[model samples]
Target: MFHPQQEQGQPSCRQNTEETDTDSDESEYNKAPDAPLTPHNMQTMLRKATTDIKSHLASELDKRLSGIKEDIESLTSRTNHMEARIKELTTSSQAHSQDSTYLHAKIEAMEESLEDLNNRSQRNNIQIRGLPEAVTMEGLHNVLKGLFKSILPEASAQDLLLYRAHRALRPQGHNGPPAFLRN
Candidate 1:
């Protein structure tokens, strides 16, 4: 059953299919029956594609710009908060510094007053010896007042003020001297 078309030493099926495809392509290429494929039509399509691409890119750029603005705003607020905190810390330190200076001055004044008080208290105190220990211990305050009256005679025993009275320790390794009462 060899066909006549196959006997001609040609690519039988391929040649037939190529001829059919080429005939259909030639008919499809002349799609616009009334108008021709012109440069203006191509330019119009190119412009439309360019406009669509530009619009898409503009929207993407706007989205990125808004995100960047949000990030910048967040950073700005954080920076403002840090600055406020730093200012608060600086103010607190300044106040503390002033308080420290005032406290130091108060402490120095207190020290001076304490020293003056010690000197005045010492002035009112008396150390006496040669009195019999028994007689001194019986009523040391009365005995001292009487002795002061006998010695001074200008001030009364009632006028003397005795804030404190005590027996103080003697110097170390000096045991030969007679014991004395210190007030």
Candidate 2:
């Protein structure tokens, strides 16, 4: 059938051109469109595309690596700062512990001094129980110096420091007629 290629006096590459004359002008015209795109040209274009893609990928990888490196360095710096803070905290803790130990020792010493002071105040005190409660406080006081001196003949009136004395309660349920005395 008469088609557009037939009207142009050209053979279509889709037909069996090999069965016809291989030296026809239409056959040469059919191959003209692919003449400039040789294997060498295609290979050179593929090489350039490969080189460009590789260079672009390399640049992208470099950017990612730099970002990761910066992140690692920042993390390391933060870790170092945390470690220093921990060290400072450890030192502060030790200082607080030492302060606590010192305070504990000082408190113990103060307690001991307070106990000694209490003992010293009571050193001159005397309590005489089972004395006759029938006597008045003046009567008890009058005989107290002589009674204390009788116990220690080595003591004089100056050494016999007798303080005021008074009566105390008897046993709670006791019906005994005599109450207790203190001097």
| Model 1 worst lDDT run, 10 consecutive residues | 172-181
lDDT string for model 2 (47-67, tens) is: 557878999999999999999
- Please estimate how well model 2 matches the true structure, expressed as its whole-model Cα lDDT: 0.68
Best by lDDT: 2
Q: Report the lDDT of model 1 for residue 41.
A: 32
Please give the distance, in angstroms, between residue 43's alpha carbon in candidate 2 and its true position after superposition: 3.5
Question: lDDT by residue for model 1 over 14-78, one digit each (tens)?
Answer: 45444555435334444654555443334334555787899999999999999999999999999
Model 1 vs truth, CA RMSD = 13.2
Alpha-carbon error at 51 in model 2, in Å? 1.5
